[model samples]
Target: MIHTISALVKNRPGVLAEMAGRFGSSQVNIRSISCGETENPEVSRMVISVEADDDAVTAITSDMESLDVVIQVDDLGRKEFVDRELVLAKLTMDRETTTQLMQIFEVFRAHVVGMGQETITVELSGDQERVDGFIQMVAPFGIRSLCRSGRIALKRGDD
Candidate 1:
Protein backbone atom coordinates (compact mmCIF):
# COMPACT_ATOMS: atom_id res chain seq x y z
CA MET A 1 0.00 0.00 0.00
CA ILE A 2 1.03 3.58 -0.63
CA HIS A 3 0.61 6.03 2.23
CA THR A 4 0.69 9.78 1.96
CA ILE A 5 2.14 11.55 4.97
CA SER A 6 1.79 15.27 5.45
CA ALA A 7 4.21 16.92 7.80
CA LEU A 8 4.50 20.50 8.96
CA VAL A 9 7.98 21.40 10.17
CA LYS A 10 9.97 24.45 11.16
CA ASN A 11 11.37 26.45 8.26
CA ARG A 12 14.96 26.06 9.33
CA PRO A 13 18.05 24.93 7.55
CA GLY A 14 18.81 21.19 7.55
CA VAL A 15 15.25 20.29 8.58
CA LEU A 16 14.60 18.45 5.33
CA ALA A 17 17.86 16.62 5.52
CA GLU A 18 17.18 15.61 9.09
CA MET A 19 13.71 14.31 8.23
CA ALA A 20 15.07 12.40 5.21
CA GLY A 21 17.74 10.83 7.37
CA ARG A 22 15.11 9.71 9.84
CA PHE A 23 13.04 8.14 7.12
CA GLY A 24 16.13 6.43 5.76
CA SER A 25 16.99 5.05 9.18
CA SER A 26 13.48 3.68 9.48
CA GLN A 27 13.93 1.88 6.15
CA VAL A 28 10.98 3.71 4.63
CA ASN A 29 11.31 4.24 0.91
CA ILE A 30 9.95 7.58 -0.16
CA ARG A 31 8.03 7.30 -3.40
CA SER A 32 7.63 11.03 -3.85
CA ILE A 33 8.08 14.10 -1.68
CA SER A 34 7.17 17.74 -2.22
CA CYS A 35 7.94 20.48 0.32
CA GLY A 36 7.53 24.24 0.40
CA GLU A 37 6.82 27.09 2.73
CA THR A 38 3.30 27.43 4.01
CA GLU A 39 1.24 30.55 4.64
CA ASN A 40 3.32 31.05 7.76
CA PRO A 41 6.85 31.75 6.64
CA GLU A 42 8.23 30.11 9.74
CA VAL A 43 6.71 26.76 8.76
CA SER A 44 6.85 24.46 5.78
CA ARG A 45 4.62 21.59 4.72
CA MET A 46 5.93 18.34 3.26
CA VAL A 47 3.76 15.84 1.43
CA ILE A 48 5.49 12.49 1.19
CA SER A 49 4.31 9.28 -0.37
CA VAL A 50 5.76 5.96 0.68
CA GLU A 51 5.04 2.39 -0.21
CA ALA A 52 4.64 0.53 3.05
CA ASP A 53 2.23 -1.59 5.01
CA ASP A 54 -0.12 -0.12 7.62
CA ASP A 55 2.13 -1.13 10.47
CA ALA A 56 5.13 0.48 8.84
CA VAL A 57 3.15 3.63 8.19
CA THR A 58 2.17 3.87 11.86
CA ALA A 59 5.76 3.47 12.94
CA ILE A 60 6.96 6.03 10.39
CA THR A 61 4.43 8.58 11.58
CA SER A 62 5.35 8.02 15.17
CA ASP A 63 9.00 8.44 14.36
CA MET A 64 8.30 11.65 12.44
CA GLU A 65 6.26 13.04 15.31
CA SER A 66 9.19 12.47 17.63
CA LEU A 67 11.35 14.87 15.68
CA ASP A 68 11.83 18.30 17.28
CA VAL A 69 11.68 20.03 13.93
CA VAL A 70 8.38 18.36 13.06
CA ILE A 71 5.42 20.43 14.15
CA GLN A 72 2.70 18.05 13.01
CA VAL A 73 2.27 14.81 11.08
CA ASP A 74 -0.85 13.38 9.51
CA ASP A 75 -1.51 10.17 7.60
CA LEU A 76 -3.48 11.68 4.77
CA GLY A 77 -3.87 8.37 3.00
CA ARG A 78 -6.55 7.39 5.49
CA LYS A 79 -8.37 10.69 5.19
CA GLU A 80 -10.34 12.52 2.58
CA PHE A 81 -7.89 14.74 0.71
CA VAL A 82 -7.28 16.39 -2.61
CA ASP A 83 -4.10 15.61 -4.48
CA ARG A 84 -2.68 16.72 -7.76
CA GLU A 85 0.41 16.52 -9.98
CA LEU A 86 1.66 18.70 -12.77
CA VAL A 87 3.21 17.48 -16.01
CA LEU A 88 4.91 19.39 -18.80
CA ALA A 89 5.55 17.58 -22.05
CA LYS A 90 7.27 18.71 -25.19
CA LEU A 91 6.03 16.73 -28.21
CA THR A 92 7.11 16.59 -31.78
CA MET A 93 4.66 18.46 -33.97
CA ASP A 94 4.15 18.94 -37.66
CA ARG A 95 1.43 20.29 -39.94
CA GLU A 96 -0.22 16.89 -40.29
CA THR A 97 -0.08 16.18 -36.56
CA THR A 98 -0.95 19.73 -35.39
CA THR A 99 -4.68 19.23 -35.78
CA GLN A 100 -4.64 15.84 -34.11
CA LEU A 101 -2.45 17.07 -31.28
CA MET A 102 -4.62 20.11 -30.73
CA GLN A 103 -7.67 17.90 -30.44
CA ILE A 104 -5.92 15.63 -27.99
CA PHE A 105 -4.73 18.58 -25.92
CA GLU A 106 -8.22 20.07 -25.88
CA VAL A 107 -9.66 16.77 -24.71
CA PHE A 108 -7.12 16.62 -21.94
CA ARG A 109 -7.61 20.31 -21.03
CA ALA A 110 -3.91 20.93 -21.55
CA HIS A 111 -2.55 24.29 -22.65
CA VAL A 112 0.17 25.01 -25.11
CA VAL A 113 2.86 26.83 -23.21
CA GLY A 114 5.44 27.11 -25.94
CA MET A 115 6.00 26.32 -29.57
CA GLY A 116 9.19 25.61 -31.46
CA GLN A 117 9.87 24.86 -35.11
CA GLU A 118 9.11 21.16 -34.63
CA THR A 119 7.96 20.84 -31.05
CA ILE A 120 5.09 22.02 -28.89
CA THR A 121 5.26 22.30 -25.14
CA VAL A 122 2.09 21.66 -23.14
CA GLU A 123 1.24 21.81 -19.46
CA LEU A 124 -1.34 19.80 -17.53
CA SER A 125 -2.20 19.64 -13.86
CA GLY A 126 -4.65 17.13 -12.43
CA ASP A 127 -5.03 13.95 -10.48
CA GLN A 128 -2.56 11.15 -11.20
CA GLU A 129 -4.93 9.22 -13.43
CA ARG A 130 -5.69 12.23 -15.58
CA VAL A 131 -2.06 13.19 -15.83
CA ASP A 132 -1.11 9.65 -16.80
CA GLY A 133 -3.86 9.54 -19.40
CA PHE A 134 -2.62 12.74 -20.96
CA ILE A 135 0.90 11.44 -21.09
CA GLN A 136 -0.22 8.19 -22.67
CA MET A 137 -2.15 10.05 -25.34
CA VAL A 138 0.80 12.23 -26.24
CA ALA A 139 3.44 9.54 -26.25
CA PRO A 140 2.39 8.38 -29.69
CA PHE A 141 3.21 11.82 -31.02
CA GLY A 142 6.82 11.37 -30.01
CA ILE A 143 7.66 13.08 -26.72
CA ARG A 144 10.78 15.24 -26.85
CA SER A 145 10.87 15.92 -23.14
CA LEU A 146 8.72 15.56 -20.05
CA CYS A 147 8.71 16.76 -16.44
CA ARG A 148 6.39 15.89 -13.57
CA SER A 149 5.89 17.47 -10.17
CA GLY A 150 5.48 14.95 -7.39
CA ARG A 151 2.13 14.50 -5.71
CA ILE A 152 0.97 17.26 -3.36
CA ALA A 153 -2.15 16.92 -1.21
CA LEU A 154 -4.24 18.56 1.50
CA LYS A 155 -6.92 17.10 3.70
CA ARG A 156 -10.54 18.06 3.19
CA GLY A 157 -12.87 19.98 5.53
CA ASP A 158 -11.91 22.33 8.34
CA ASP A 159 -9.05 20.76 10.23
Candidate 2:
Protein backbone atom coordinates (compact mmCIF):
# COMPACT_ATOMS: atom_id res chain seq x y z
CA MET A 1 0.00 0.00 0.00
CA ILE A 2 0.99 3.61 -0.44
CA HIS A 3 1.30 5.91 2.55
CA THR A 4 2.22 9.49 3.08
CA ILE A 5 4.50 10.00 6.07
CA SER A 6 5.19 13.39 7.50
CA ALA A 7 8.33 13.55 9.58
CA LEU A 8 9.64 16.40 11.67
CA VAL A 9 13.39 16.17 12.05
CA LYS A 10 16.18 18.23 13.51
CA ASN A 11 17.80 20.25 10.73
CA ARG A 12 21.35 19.09 10.36
CA PRO A 13 23.67 18.13 7.56
CA GLY A 14 23.43 14.48 6.45
CA VAL A 15 20.08 13.94 8.19
CA LEU A 16 18.07 13.97 4.97
CA ALA A 17 20.55 11.76 3.16
CA GLU A 18 20.48 9.21 5.94
CA MET A 19 16.70 9.10 6.01
CA ALA A 20 16.50 8.72 2.25
CA GLY A 21 19.10 5.99 2.32
CA ARG A 22 17.19 4.16 4.98
CA PHE A 23 14.09 4.08 2.79
CA GLY A 24 16.08 2.98 -0.21
CA SER A 25 17.85 0.21 1.64
CA SER A 26 14.52 -1.09 2.86
CA GLN A 27 13.19 -1.17 -0.75
CA VAL A 28 10.51 1.38 -0.06
CA ASN A 29 9.57 3.14 -3.26
CA ILE A 30 9.57 6.84 -2.43
CA ARG A 31 7.19 8.60 -4.79
CA SER A 32 7.63 12.19 -3.72
CA ILE A 33 9.14 14.40 -1.04
CA SER A 34 8.55 17.93 0.15
CA CYS A 35 10.37 19.62 3.00
CA GLY A 36 10.97 22.99 4.57
CA GLU A 37 12.70 24.43 7.58
CA THR A 38 10.44 24.76 10.59
CA GLU A 39 9.99 27.87 12.72
CA ASN A 40 12.71 26.50 14.93
CA PRO A 41 15.92 26.90 12.94
CA GLU A 42 17.05 23.53 14.16
CA VAL A 43 14.07 21.63 12.85
CA SER A 44 12.72 20.66 9.44
CA ARG A 45 9.64 18.74 8.36
CA MET A 46 9.12 16.47 5.36
CA VAL A 47 6.15 14.81 3.73
CA ILE A 48 7.24 11.63 1.99
CA SER A 49 5.08 9.36 -0.15
CA VAL A 50 6.10 5.73 -0.45
CA GLU A 51 4.87 2.37 -1.71
CA ALA A 52 5.63 -0.50 0.62
CA ASP A 53 4.26 -3.60 2.22
CA ASP A 54 2.84 -3.52 5.76
CA ASP A 55 5.91 -5.12 7.29
CA ALA A 56 8.39 -2.92 5.45
CA VAL A 57 6.31 0.16 6.16
CA THR A 58 6.20 -0.61 9.87
CA ALA A 59 9.92 -1.21 10.00
CA ILE A 60 10.69 2.05 8.27
CA THR A 61 8.27 4.02 10.40
CA SER A 62 9.62 2.54 13.62
CA ASP A 63 13.19 3.28 12.62
CA MET A 64 12.22 6.80 11.70
CA GLU A 65 10.42 7.33 15.00
CA SER A 66 13.47 6.18 16.91
CA LEU A 67 15.81 8.51 15.07
CA ASP A 68 17.43 10.93 17.50
CA VAL A 69 16.52 13.80 15.19
CA VAL A 70 12.95 12.87 14.26
CA ILE A 71 10.31 14.54 16.41
CA GLN A 72 7.14 13.13 14.84
CA VAL A 73 5.76 10.88 12.12
CA ASP A 74 2.21 10.73 10.83
CA ASP A 75 0.79 8.29 8.30
CA LEU A 76 -1.52 10.04 5.86
CA GLY A 77 -3.87 7.64 4.14
CA ARG A 78 -5.12 8.38 0.62
CA LYS A 79 -8.89 8.44 1.10
CA GLU A 80 -9.20 10.34 4.36
CA PHE A 81 -6.64 13.03 3.65
CA VAL A 82 -6.39 16.25 1.73
CA ASP A 83 -3.54 16.34 -0.78
CA ARG A 84 -1.99 19.39 -2.38
CA GLU A 85 0.71 20.10 -4.96
CA LEU A 86 2.44 23.21 -6.20
CA VAL A 87 3.62 23.54 -9.81
CA LEU A 88 5.72 26.29 -11.30
CA ALA A 89 6.54 26.72 -14.96
CA LYS A 90 8.85 29.21 -16.62
CA LEU A 91 7.03 29.56 -19.95
CA THR A 92 8.49 31.54 -22.78
CA MET A 93 5.89 33.45 -24.70
CA ASP A 94 5.34 36.65 -26.62
CA ARG A 95 3.02 39.52 -25.58
CA GLU A 96 0.10 38.19 -27.58
CA THR A 97 0.67 34.66 -26.36
CA THR A 98 0.87 35.89 -22.78
CA THR A 99 -2.53 37.57 -22.96
CA GLN A 100 -4.13 34.45 -24.37
CA LEU A 101 -2.53 32.27 -21.69
CA MET A 102 -3.71 34.55 -18.90
CA GLN A 103 -7.29 33.73 -19.80
CA ILE A 104 -6.56 30.01 -19.61
CA PHE A 105 -4.89 30.38 -16.21
CA GLU A 106 -7.82 32.36 -14.82
CA VAL A 107 -10.07 29.42 -15.56
CA PHE A 108 -7.83 27.19 -13.41
CA ARG A 109 -7.26 29.67 -10.57
CA ALA A 110 -3.58 29.83 -11.45
CA HIS A 111 -1.63 33.08 -11.68
CA VAL A 112 1.50 34.34 -13.20
CA VAL A 113 4.06 34.75 -10.47
CA GLY A 114 6.46 36.62 -12.71
CA MET A 115 6.68 37.47 -16.38
CA GLY A 116 8.50 39.17 -19.20
CA GLN A 117 7.68 39.80 -22.87
CA GLU A 118 9.08 36.39 -23.80
CA THR A 119 8.82 34.45 -20.57
CA ILE A 120 6.43 33.98 -17.66
CA THR A 121 6.47 31.96 -14.48
CA VAL A 122 3.19 30.56 -13.20
CA GLU A 123 2.22 29.04 -9.87
CA LEU A 124 -0.67 26.66 -9.31
CA SER A 125 -1.65 24.95 -6.09
CA GLY A 126 -4.19 22.15 -6.02
CA ASP A 127 -4.60 18.39 -5.88
CA GLN A 128 -2.02 16.24 -7.68
CA GLU A 129 -4.28 15.22 -10.56
CA ARG A 130 -5.46 18.79 -11.14
CA VAL A 131 -1.88 20.05 -11.18
CA ASP A 132 -0.87 17.34 -13.65
CA GLY A 133 -3.86 18.18 -15.79
CA PHE A 134 -2.72 21.77 -15.97
CA ILE A 135 0.75 20.68 -16.96
CA GLN A 136 -0.57 18.45 -19.73
CA MET A 137 -2.66 21.30 -21.05
CA VAL A 138 0.33 23.60 -21.14
CA ALA A 139 3.10 21.25 -22.20
CA PRO A 140 2.96 22.36 -25.83
CA PHE A 141 4.13 25.87 -25.05
CA GLY A 142 7.24 24.95 -23.10
CA ILE A 143 8.34 23.86 -19.65
CA ARG A 144 11.65 25.03 -18.21
CA SER A 145 11.39 22.93 -15.10
CA LEU A 146 8.86 21.35 -12.83
CA CYS A 147 8.60 21.00 -9.05
CA ARG A 148 6.08 19.14 -6.93
CA SER A 149 5.21 19.00 -3.24
CA GLY A 150 3.97 15.66 -1.99
CA ARG A 151 0.77 15.02 -0.05
CA ILE A 152 0.49 16.47 3.46
CA ALA A 153 -2.51 15.13 5.31
CA LEU A 154 -4.43 16.28 8.34
CA LYS A 155 -6.93 14.44 10.55
CA ARG A 156 -10.41 15.87 10.05
CA GLY A 157 -12.17 18.06 12.61
CA ASP A 158 -11.86 19.18 16.17
CA ASP A 159 -8.84 17.49 17.60
Candidate 3:
Protein backbone atom coordinates (compact mmCIF):
# COMPACT_ATOMS: atom_id res chain seq x y z
CA MET A 1 0.00 0.00 0.00
CA ILE A 2 1.03 3.59 -0.53
CA HIS A 3 1.25 5.72 2.61
CA THR A 4 1.61 9.46 2.84
CA ILE A 5 3.54 10.74 5.82
CA SER A 6 3.77 14.41 6.62
CA ALA A 7 6.22 15.79 9.13
CA LEU A 8 6.58 19.21 10.65
CA VAL A 9 10.28 19.85 11.17
CA LYS A 10 12.63 22.61 12.12
CA ASN A 11 13.91 24.51 9.11
CA ARG A 12 17.54 23.82 9.81
CA PRO A 13 20.42 22.69 7.68
CA GLY A 14 20.93 18.93 7.26
CA VAL A 15 17.40 18.23 8.50
CA LEU A 16 16.40 16.63 5.22
CA ALA A 17 19.49 14.52 5.05
CA GLU A 18 19.03 13.34 8.60
CA MET A 19 15.41 12.42 7.95
CA ALA A 20 16.36 10.55 4.79
CA GLY A 21 19.04 8.63 6.64
CA ARG A 22 16.49 7.64 9.24
CA PHE A 23 14.14 6.38 6.56
CA GLY A 24 16.96 4.45 4.99
CA SER A 25 17.87 2.84 8.29
CA SER A 26 14.25 1.84 8.74
CA GLN A 27 14.34 0.14 5.34
CA VAL A 28 11.52 2.22 3.93
CA ASN A 29 11.63 3.08 0.26
CA ILE A 30 10.22 6.53 -0.34
CA ARG A 31 8.21 6.81 -3.55
CA SER A 32 7.99 10.57 -3.48
CA ILE A 33 8.99 13.45 -1.25
CA SER A 34 8.44 17.21 -1.16
CA CYS A 35 9.15 19.87 1.42
CA GLY A 36 8.46 23.56 1.73
CA GLU A 37 8.39 26.33 4.26
CA THR A 38 5.17 26.53 6.26
CA GLU A 39 3.34 29.58 7.55
CA ASN A 40 5.85 29.57 10.38
CA PRO A 41 9.13 30.28 8.69
CA GLU A 42 11.00 28.36 11.37
CA VAL A 43 9.25 25.20 10.34
CA SER A 44 8.91 23.21 7.13
CA ARG A 45 6.40 20.63 6.03
CA MET A 46 7.86 17.44 4.61
CA VAL A 47 5.51 15.11 2.83
CA ILE A 48 6.68 11.65 1.85
CA SER A 49 5.04 8.77 0.08
CA VAL A 50 6.20 5.19 0.47
CA GLU A 51 4.94 1.80 -0.60
CA ALA A 52 5.20 -0.73 2.20
CA ASP A 53 3.24 -3.03 4.38
CA ASP A 54 1.38 -1.70 7.40
CA ASP A 55 3.99 -2.86 9.86
CA ALA A 56 6.81 -1.27 7.88
CA VAL A 57 4.90 1.99 7.66
CA THR A 58 4.29 1.93 11.38
CA ALA A 59 7.96 1.37 12.04
CA ILE A 60 9.04 4.14 9.71
CA THR A 61 6.56 6.58 11.20
CA SER A 62 7.74 5.81 14.70
CA ASP A 63 11.34 6.24 13.60
CA MET A 64 10.59 9.58 11.95
CA GLU A 65 8.76 10.88 15.00
CA SER A 66 11.79 10.19 17.09
CA LEU A 67 13.99 12.51 15.07
CA ASP A 68 15.22 15.64 16.86
CA VAL A 69 14.20 18.00 14.03
CA VAL A 70 10.75 16.51 13.55
CA ILE A 71 8.12 18.27 15.65
CA GLN A 72 5.17 16.15 14.56
CA VAL A 73 4.20 13.47 12.09
CA ASP A 74 0.85 12.81 10.51
CA ASP A 75 -0.24 9.75 8.59
CA LEU A 76 -2.19 11.18 5.68
CA GLY A 77 -2.65 7.88 3.92
CA ARG A 78 -5.99 7.31 5.61
CA LYS A 79 -7.03 10.90 5.60
CA GLU A 80 -8.92 13.05 3.14
CA PHE A 81 -6.27 14.78 1.10
CA VAL A 82 -5.66 16.16 -2.37
CA ASP A 83 -2.67 14.82 -4.31
CA ARG A 84 -1.17 16.13 -7.52
CA GLU A 85 1.81 15.76 -9.85
CA LEU A 86 3.23 17.97 -12.56
CA VAL A 87 4.60 16.76 -15.89
CA LEU A 88 6.33 18.49 -18.77
CA ALA A 89 6.38 16.61 -22.04
CA LYS A 90 8.15 17.46 -25.28
CA LEU A 91 6.59 15.90 -28.33
CA THR A 92 7.59 15.93 -31.95
CA MET A 93 4.77 17.02 -34.21
CA ASP A 94 4.27 18.33 -37.72
CA ARG A 95 1.64 20.83 -38.90
CA GLU A 96 -0.86 18.06 -39.54
CA THR A 97 -0.32 16.60 -36.10
CA THR A 98 -0.17 19.94 -34.32
CA THR A 99 -3.93 20.39 -34.47
CA GLN A 100 -4.53 16.94 -33.02
CA LEU A 101 -1.96 17.60 -30.32
CA MET A 102 -3.68 20.83 -29.38
CA GLN A 103 -6.98 19.00 -29.06
CA ILE A 104 -5.38 16.37 -26.89
CA PHE A 105 -3.84 19.04 -24.69
CA GLU A 106 -7.22 20.76 -24.35
CA VAL A 107 -8.94 17.51 -23.46
CA PHE A 108 -6.29 16.80 -20.84
CA ARG A 109 -6.45 20.33 -19.51
CA ALA A 110 -2.75 20.71 -20.32
CA HIS A 111 -1.25 23.78 -21.95
CA VAL A 112 1.27 24.36 -24.66
CA VAL A 113 4.02 26.04 -22.72
CA GLY A 114 6.43 26.17 -25.68
CA MET A 115 6.54 25.29 -29.32
CA GLY A 116 9.10 24.78 -32.11
CA GLN A 117 8.90 24.05 -35.78
CA GLU A 118 8.72 20.31 -35.18
CA THR A 119 8.24 20.11 -31.40
CA ILE A 120 5.70 21.15 -28.83
CA THR A 121 6.19 21.22 -25.09
CA VAL A 122 3.23 20.94 -22.77
CA GLU A 123 2.86 21.35 -19.06
CA LEU A 124 0.33 19.23 -17.21
CA SER A 125 -0.67 19.08 -13.60
CA GLY A 126 -3.12 16.64 -12.09
CA ASP A 127 -3.31 13.46 -10.12
CA GLN A 128 -0.76 10.77 -11.05
CA GLU A 129 -3.36 8.78 -12.95
CA ARG A 130 -4.41 11.73 -15.07
CA VAL A 131 -0.81 12.57 -15.95
CA ASP A 132 -0.13 8.95 -16.84
CA GLY A 133 -3.20 8.86 -19.05
CA PHE A 134 -2.10 11.97 -20.88
CA ILE A 135 1.33 10.49 -21.53
CA GLN A 136 -0.20 7.30 -22.82
CA MET A 137 -2.45 9.23 -25.15
CA VAL A 138 0.44 11.23 -26.59
CA ALA A 139 2.94 8.41 -26.81
CA PRO A 140 1.95 7.58 -30.39
CA PHE A 141 3.33 10.99 -31.27
CA GLY A 142 7.10 10.96 -30.84
CA ILE A 143 7.93 11.96 -27.29
CA ARG A 144 11.35 13.56 -27.21
CA SER A 145 11.52 13.96 -23.48
CA LEU A 146 9.42 14.29 -20.36
CA CYS A 147 9.82 15.10 -16.68
CA ARG A 148 7.47 14.75 -13.74
CA SER A 149 7.26 16.06 -10.25
CA GLY A 150 6.33 13.22 -8.00
CA ARG A 151 3.22 13.30 -5.86
CA ILE A 152 2.57 16.13 -3.47
CA ALA A 153 -0.48 16.21 -1.22
CA LEU A 154 -2.34 18.31 1.32
CA LYS A 155 -5.07 17.55 3.79
CA ARG A 156 -8.56 18.57 2.69
CA GLY A 157 -10.12 20.26 5.70
CA ASP A 158 -9.36 22.88 8.31
CA ASP A 159 -8.08 20.17 10.57
Candidate 4:
Protein backbone atom coordinates (compact mmCIF):
# COMPACT_ATOMS: atom_id res chain seq x y z
CA MET A 1 0.00 0.00 0.00
CA ILE A 2 1.04 3.55 -0.66
CA HIS A 3 0.33 6.13 2.02
CA THR A 4 0.18 9.82 1.33
CA ILE A 5 1.16 11.77 4.41
CA SER A 6 0.80 15.52 4.59
CA ALA A 7 2.86 17.48 7.05
CA LEU A 8 2.81 21.16 7.81
CA VAL A 9 6.15 22.23 9.16
CA LYS A 10 8.06 25.39 9.90
CA ASN A 11 9.45 26.93 6.76
CA ARG A 12 13.09 26.68 7.70
CA PRO A 13 16.20 25.09 6.32
CA GLY A 14 16.90 21.47 7.31
CA VAL A 15 13.24 20.70 7.95
CA LEU A 16 13.04 18.58 4.82
CA ALA A 17 16.20 16.72 5.72
CA GLU A 18 14.85 16.09 9.18
CA MET A 19 11.65 14.62 7.79
CA ALA A 20 13.51 12.42 5.33
CA GLY A 21 15.78 11.23 8.13
CA ARG A 22 12.80 10.21 10.18
CA PHE A 23 11.44 8.21 7.28
CA GLY A 24 14.78 6.56 6.75
CA SER A 25 15.10 5.61 10.39
CA SER A 26 11.64 4.12 10.32
CA GLN A 27 12.59 1.99 7.28
CA VAL A 28 9.95 3.57 5.11
CA ASN A 29 10.45 3.76 1.37
CA ILE A 30 9.48 7.18 0.12
CA ARG A 31 7.83 7.13 -3.25
CA SER A 32 7.62 10.87 -3.74
CA ILE A 33 7.89 14.00 -1.66
CA SER A 34 6.68 17.48 -2.58
CA CYS A 35 7.09 20.47 -0.33
CA GLY A 36 6.34 24.15 -0.82
CA GLU A 37 5.33 27.26 1.01
CA THR A 38 1.76 27.55 2.15
CA GLU A 39 -0.44 30.63 2.46
CA ASN A 40 1.38 31.31 5.70
CA PRO A 41 4.96 32.16 4.88
CA GLU A 42 6.13 30.70 8.13
CA VAL A 43 4.79 27.29 7.24
CA SER A 44 5.31 24.81 4.43
CA ARG A 45 3.18 21.85 3.41
CA MET A 46 4.96 18.61 2.62
CA VAL A 47 3.23 15.79 0.88
CA ILE A 48 5.14 12.54 1.17
CA SER A 49 4.12 9.30 -0.45
CA VAL A 50 5.55 6.11 0.97
CA GLU A 51 5.17 2.50 0.00
CA ALA A 52 4.50 0.76 3.25
CA ASP A 53 2.08 -1.43 5.09
CA ASP A 54 -0.34 -0.26 7.76
CA ASP A 55 2.09 -0.73 10.60
CA ALA A 56 4.86 1.14 8.81
CA VAL A 57 2.52 3.98 7.91
CA THR A 58 1.47 4.33 11.53
CA ALA A 59 5.05 4.30 12.74
CA ILE A 60 6.11 6.86 10.15
CA THR A 61 3.28 9.21 10.99
CA SER A 62 3.90 8.83 14.71
CA ASP A 63 7.57 9.57 14.25
CA MET A 64 6.80 12.59 12.08
CA GLU A 65 4.33 13.96 14.63
CA SER A 66 6.99 13.74 17.28
CA LEU A 67 9.20 16.17 15.41
CA ASP A 68 9.24 19.70 16.81
CA VAL A 69 9.43 21.17 13.31
CA VAL A 70 6.26 19.39 12.25
CA ILE A 71 3.29 21.56 13.08
CA GLN A 72 0.70 19.04 11.92
CA VAL A 73 0.60 15.61 10.31
CA ASP A 74 -2.26 13.98 8.50
CA ASP A 75 -2.59 10.61 6.81
CA LEU A 76 -4.18 11.90 3.63
CA GLY A 77 -4.31 8.42 2.17
CA ARG A 78 -6.97 7.57 4.71
CA LYS A 79 -9.02 10.65 3.87
CA GLU A 80 -10.77 12.13 0.89
CA PHE A 81 -8.25 14.31 -0.89
CA VAL A 82 -7.34 15.58 -4.29
CA ASP A 83 -3.81 15.03 -5.60
CA ARG A 84 -2.03 16.34 -8.64
CA GLU A 85 1.33 16.07 -10.36
CA LEU A 86 2.90 18.20 -13.05
CA VAL A 87 4.86 16.83 -15.98
CA LEU A 88 6.97 18.55 -18.61
CA ALA A 89 8.00 16.51 -21.61
CA LYS A 90 10.21 17.38 -24.54
CA LEU A 91 9.24 15.38 -27.61
CA THR A 92 10.90 15.15 -30.95
CA MET A 93 8.88 17.13 -33.46
CA ASP A 94 8.77 17.35 -37.21
CA ARG A 95 6.44 18.72 -39.87
CA GLU A 96 4.80 15.37 -40.48
CA THR A 97 4.01 14.83 -36.80
CA THR A 98 3.38 18.42 -35.72
CA THR A 99 -0.35 18.34 -36.42
CA GLN A 100 -0.77 14.88 -34.93
CA LEU A 101 1.19 15.91 -31.82
CA MET A 102 -0.92 19.00 -31.43
CA GLN A 103 -4.05 16.88 -31.52
CA ILE A 104 -2.65 14.59 -28.85
CA PHE A 105 -1.73 17.55 -26.70
CA GLU A 106 -5.22 18.98 -27.10
CA VAL A 107 -6.78 15.70 -26.05
CA PHE A 108 -4.68 15.65 -22.91
CA ARG A 109 -5.26 19.36 -22.26
CA ALA A 110 -1.50 19.91 -22.39
CA HIS A 111 -0.01 23.12 -23.66
CA VAL A 112 3.24 23.82 -25.39
CA VAL A 113 5.71 25.57 -23.13
CA GLY A 114 8.64 25.68 -25.50
CA MET A 115 9.54 24.92 -29.08
CA GLY A 116 12.98 24.22 -30.45
CA GLN A 117 14.08 23.45 -33.96
CA GLU A 118 13.34 19.75 -33.54
CA THR A 119 11.66 19.50 -30.16
CA ILE A 120 8.44 20.67 -28.55
CA THR A 121 8.10 20.93 -24.79
CA VAL A 122 4.65 20.49 -23.28
CA GLU A 123 3.30 20.73 -19.78
CA LEU A 124 0.51 18.78 -18.15
CA SER A 125 -0.84 18.75 -14.62
CA GLY A 126 -3.24 16.13 -13.38
CA ASP A 127 -3.58 13.02 -11.28
CA GLN A 128 -1.12 10.13 -11.63
CA GLU A 129 -3.31 8.19 -14.04
CA ARG A 130 -3.87 11.19 -16.26
CA VAL A 131 -0.19 12.01 -16.27
CA ASP A 132 0.70 8.43 -17.12
CA GLY A 133 -1.82 8.43 -19.97
CA PHE A 134 -0.39 11.65 -21.34
CA ILE A 135 3.10 10.23 -21.22
CA GLN A 136 2.00 7.06 -22.95
CA MET A 137 0.38 9.09 -25.70
CA VAL A 138 3.45 11.22 -26.22
CA ALA A 139 6.06 8.50 -25.81
CA PRO A 140 5.58 7.24 -29.37
CA PHE A 141 6.63 10.63 -30.65
CA GLY A 142 10.06 10.03 -29.09
CA ILE A 143 10.53 11.71 -25.74
CA ARG A 144 13.80 13.57 -25.51
CA SER A 145 13.39 14.48 -21.87
CA LEU A 146 10.79 14.55 -19.14
CA CYS A 147 10.34 15.99 -15.69
CA ARG A 148 7.63 15.30 -13.13
CA SER A 149 6.70 17.11 -9.95
CA GLY A 150 6.04 14.79 -7.05
CA ARG A 151 2.45 14.35 -5.97
CA ILE A 152 0.84 17.01 -3.80
CA ALA A 153 -2.54 16.65 -2.14
CA LEU A 154 -5.03 18.40 0.12
CA LYS A 155 -7.89 16.93 2.05
CA ARG A 156 -11.47 17.74 1.12
CA GLY A 157 -14.05 19.71 3.11
CA ASP A 158 -13.42 22.17 5.96
CA ASP A 159 -10.81 20.95 8.35
Q: What are the lDDT scores of the predictions, listed in order?
A: 0.93, 0.80, 0.89, 0.94
Model 2 deviation from native, Cα RMSD in Å: 2.4
Off by over 4 Å in 3: none
Worst 10 residues of 1 by lDDT: 17-26
Model 2, span 20-137: residue lDDT tens: 8889999788998877787888899887888887778779989999989899877766336677888888876875676667876887789888977678889999887888888887
lDDT of 1 by residue, 28-136 (tens): 8988888999999999999898988999889888988988899999999889999999999999999999999999999999999999999999999999899999999
- The local distance difference test score of model 1 is 0.93
* lDDT top scorer: 4
Strongest candidate by TM-score: 4
**Listing every candidate in turn, what is its Cα RMSD in Å to the true structure after a full C-alpha superposition?**
1.1, 2.4, 1.4, 0.8
- Residue 147's lDDT within candidate 4 is 94
Model 4, residue 108: distance off in Å is: 0.7
TM-score of each: 0.95, 0.82, 0.92, 0.97
What local lDDT score does residue 59 receive in model 4, on the 0 to 100 scale? 84
Q: Which scores higher on TM-score, 1 or 2?
A: 1
> Which ranges of candidate 4 are over 4 A from the true structure?
none
Worst 10 residues of 4 by lDDT: 21-30
